[model samples]
Target: VKTTVSVIKADIGSFPGHSRTHPKILEVAARRLKEVEGSILIDSYVTHCGDDLELIMTHTKGEDNEEIHKLAWDIFMECAGLAKEMKLYGAGQDLLGDAFSGNVKGMGPGVAEMEFEERGSDPILIFMADKTEPGAWNYFLYKIFADPFSTSGLVIDPSLHDGFTFEVHDVIEKRKILFNTPEESYSLLAYIGAPSRYVIKYVWKRDGTIGASTSTQRLNLMAGRYVGKDDPVMVIRAQSGFPAVGEVIDPFRTPILVAGWMRGSHHGPFMPVGVADANCTAFDGPPRVICLGFQVCNGKLIGPADMFDDPAFNRVRDQCCDLSSVLRAHGPFEPHRLSLEEMEYTTLPGVEKQFKDRWEDLPE
Candidate 1:
């Protein structure tokens, strides 16, 4: 058996406050996917992460197929139109590039796909994130594949004792050169810790087994302009030879901080929340992530175990809620405000323009 899972996401609209998407808009997207089912998908699901709408599709069309990508794009565009009708906020917001071109790669959305030979039992996890860049997965990936404390498989399971290798990418570079983890763990960590410029593209076990993969592509890098915020998406294959679901999910439980929110301009903890949860409070977010569990067979989707609903996660959410309140109180001050580096890609340019004269006299 073979399985192909494609996870693509776009920000069609957000409420007037730029916090959530209109329910009707999501329904329109569902309707469009239903219309294209026979032509494009085997089994599909639609859901939101913050203000973005994500289309989780199972198909044999392979990655980046125009017929498939366009189907999702058209649905989002239609949803965007509906958002406009309701006068929703940020309608058609993240559709940065003028044309969709061959695919949405750098146009504004985040895309991650995996095609592999199916196991006796197939399991995959879909991750949708709001308020963070592709690099948010840095720590999670490191924990799942590198740390034995988190992934006991390394110490207890012989099949996983050998650490995994990661292909790290320098997203800022035009030419993509990848460096590996384990052997180059320190070097990889040094680069990925920067987050904004480096991202984890894929990971494979020491014995050559693929552990995970993510679409490290960033839109602002390609567009040369910050059209809108980057709402990233991810997919990870769990169990069997890879890390167990527990390991993959362990890192998120900590809701450790990352950069993103209200225009992709700040750092905050990546809260793990359930389906239907709204965006962050105050200046937009403490950043959030949603996980969907699934099993695939013969190139189709099976289960999406809305992981956040489990009783164990309930405690984590409580912690997140408390953290949000504390952080919100800080408002625009240090530690709460996005660091100056992360602010560069956002509206800070406009702020910079206001003080452009400050540098005039010191320069030629």
Candidate 2:
């Protein structure tokens, strides 16, 4: 069976400010999404990470299907109206456009879609992040697809030994390039290492089978200003020819630092949290990531086994909290706060202009 999985997410609004989505608004989104099921989707799940609501659906419509995209767009708009009436925080905040332009790509929401022939037991995983940019997934993608330390399969499994290919996007330039791994892994890193500018858009197995994908929309670029952080969603297919489920989730156990915290302006550990615990608080984050694992049979979505809802991840979350305090102590310093260039949504540019004349000329 050919299955197309589309995950679209946006910060329609949050209850009491960037913390969580209200139950009422989720009801609005859930109800609308349910309406399109028999006609537009095979199976659908509505969930959220931090303030962004996610519509995860399985369909045969393929990637970038206008009807599917429009369904997501319509759901968000209706939810936004409910949010507005409820006086929710940042209501309709991520809907940057006055109207949907036949698709939601530039309109505001972050989307990641993939279509593939389902294996006998198609186990898929989604990593949804809150309070971070899309580039935040770069490191995780690299570790799972390229690094032998995290992905033991890379060294042991013959299928993975040939290595995978990376599709990277320069979010600022809105351009992309592909690099085959095992040979070009380091070359791939030289760019994604920055994370803020370059992002891994997709990954493919040696046989050209798609392995993973991340939403590449930099909301700042589309909105021409900072509206909300490009809190991203990612899809990864596991087992068989690809990395095992363990290899994919191993990288997050270390709690790597990523750009996105309070106001999308700081660096913080991307904490792996259970879906129920995914809300932006703490200094507006220690950015949270929730992984939902599913087994697809025919066209049905069988499980969203909250991947991090295990005791195994408790230490990771605790370590992330400890690290967040250390970074937060820096309080506006580099390596903690994002650099000027990375602060694409910040007021730093105008602040730079205001302070420009006060500086004395430096020695040549």
Which predicted model would earn the best TM-score? 2
lDDT score, candidate 1: 0.76
Tens digits of per-residue lDDT, candidate 2, 234-319, equal: 99999988899988998889888988788888889999999889988888887999999999887788988999998999899889
**Can you give the TM-score per candidate against the true fold?**
0.91, 0.96
Tell me the tens digit of each residue's lDDT in model 1 across 98-160: 566788776677788776777887688888887778888888888888777788887898877
CA lDDT of every candidate: 0.76, 0.88
Pairs in clash, predicted candidate 1: none
- Please name the candidate that would achieve the greatest lDDT relative to the true structure: 2
Native-to-model Cα distance after best TM-score fit, residue 30 in candidate 1, in Å: 1.8
